[model samples]
Target: MGVKITGIGSYIPSEIAKNEHFGKHHFYNEDGTRFGHENDVIIEKFKAITGISERRYLPKTLVTSDIASFAAENALKNASLNKEELDYIIVAHNYGDVNYDSVQSDTVPSIATRVKHNLKIEKPTCVAYDVLFGCPGWIEGMIQANAFIKSGIAKKCLVIGAESLSRVVDPHDRDSMIYSDGAGAAIVEKSSEEGGILSHYSATFAFEEAHFIYFGESNNLELKDTRRYIKMYGRKIYEFALSNVPDAMKTCLDQSGISVDEVKMIFIHQANEKMDEAIVNRFYKLYDRTPPKDSMPMSIDKLGNSSVATIPTLYDLVLNNELKGYSVKENDVVIFASVGAGMNINAIVYRI
Candidate 1:
């Protein structure tokens, strides 16, 4: 028997921010030049390199819970389960609804209340909490949910990975141009089956290679400064992901008694196109097998790296015929791998 993912859903804010919109930033050079301004060059240089055609963002009036509520409701409906049956709710977010000023505030409780009210769910015994990590958050949440159920501590779990990254984006920085806002949710239930979450491997290298992905002042007064936005060492991160994730993937498959050659598909955190290609190429070299010619899937192009939400959102897109002809079925081993800003990497195998 194994824990199974019954349903999955994703929510992108209605507001769409495009790459061309960055043209309005007044940091251009005398020759009408700006770093990463050329569309094609920018696309080719970055890992997830497609110009983010459009991305969703929560309006000023909305918060993280609102985005989460939408995703959770859709996930529950897709799973054909009632919200009342949810034994636990796990929210994975690096940025919360309230700004840093309200870190001491009861933001978790308030967000929980709003989720319950919006979804019309009965108060759950385990109603509140947040998990802070880098991009590997959603995969970590799933691993935790599976553990909770396997321990008989929960019957069903709603695992949500949501982020309103626009709040942390430095409008003037070209690196931030690819970031947008979104949320994703999954409904997991315990089943006496052979598939579900087969194995998970996670590791964090806390070395100070290039640690600053997102930063804010320890004092509230620094909120107004542009430094408060996310800053990424793109080259270092790309190198880290390329070198680390392939080993992590091999470790997961090795522990699961499955060879990488046997797996049918791989779903990586949709960080960028170039990164995706690099990882996929590595897989090809390591296994000496081609990836079924179109099996590598990505959503970073349009979704603009929805952080933790990227994987699940890409999963939904695949399941909903967005990726036509690529079908996931029983006994097929699918791998989920991610590397987040904390120099953290998570790789898991799931059989469906």
Candidate 2:
């Protein structure tokens, strides 16, 4: 038995924030000190490095669960499955809802619970929960669903990645610009077919790099704020991705009993265009072959990095043929690779 993705869904906020908007604001260092560089130069370098032109963010009134339920409803609809039919609803999120005036936030009822409430799911047997595996949370939720199905526990599961990064981002911090808000979800079901979720591999490097993406202190302590926003060590993460991520992808592909040439497409986390491209190139080099052009499609140019939502949202785009020249057909091998906070790195191989 295997588990396979049956449907995909996504929700992007209507608000479009361009690089210029961010340029208008002054960013500060982690210590709250002001940056000396001009905003234009900084944005140009950011675009050159990350390839992000614009991104979406939900209205401040909205919360992470609201974003998730939108995607979940669409996913269940796409699968022609009702919410009551779901055996599990797993939500992956970093911060719950920080819509309050204070920096303090809570996930007490769980994001999954809030989504279930949003969907009005009446099935008592349906389990609703949340996962906190950094940006890989959604993928980890999928992995867990695979285990549940393979072990004869669950038949269908909904895995969602919803983030309100704008709430957690330090607007004055340039690195905070790397994030946006969005939600993506997939419906997975047990299948007797030979191909579905083939294999998965992941690792947590929590030593020196653990603090690479952290929430130590607030850059802005004004406005009665006390929330810890996301802070990333860009160079350190870039170097880490280049060094370790490719090997993790290779390990997943190797364990799947397939080679680099067999994969029809690769869905990599939209962390950074350059870093993702380099990692894929290195993966192909392991087989002594050049990486195929456009095999790895990217959405960071417009969507920015939506954290855990990136892969699934991109997956939805490809499935609907919304992406140019990137589509998933039957019996095609696909590889997914991601590296994010928690210092988490993981890869998943699937056949459709």
Specify the highest-TM-score model's number. 2
lDDT of 1 at 256: 90
Candidates in order: C-alpha RMSD to true structure: 4.2, 1.5
lDDT of 2 by residue, 105-153 (tens): 6798998999999999999989999988888888888899999889988
Residue ranges of candidate 1 with Cα displaced over 4 Å: 27-51, 98-114, 209-212, 216-227
Model 1: pairs clashing at backbone N, Cα or C within 3 Å: 1-192, 1-193, 47-272, 47-273, 47-274, 47-275, 48-272, 48-273, 49-273
Candidate 2 overall Cα lDDT vs. reference?
A: 0.88
Taken over the whole model, the C-alpha lDDT of each candidate is 0.76, 0.88
Every model's TM-score = 0.87, 0.96
List clashing residue pairs in candidate 2: 27-172, 331-352
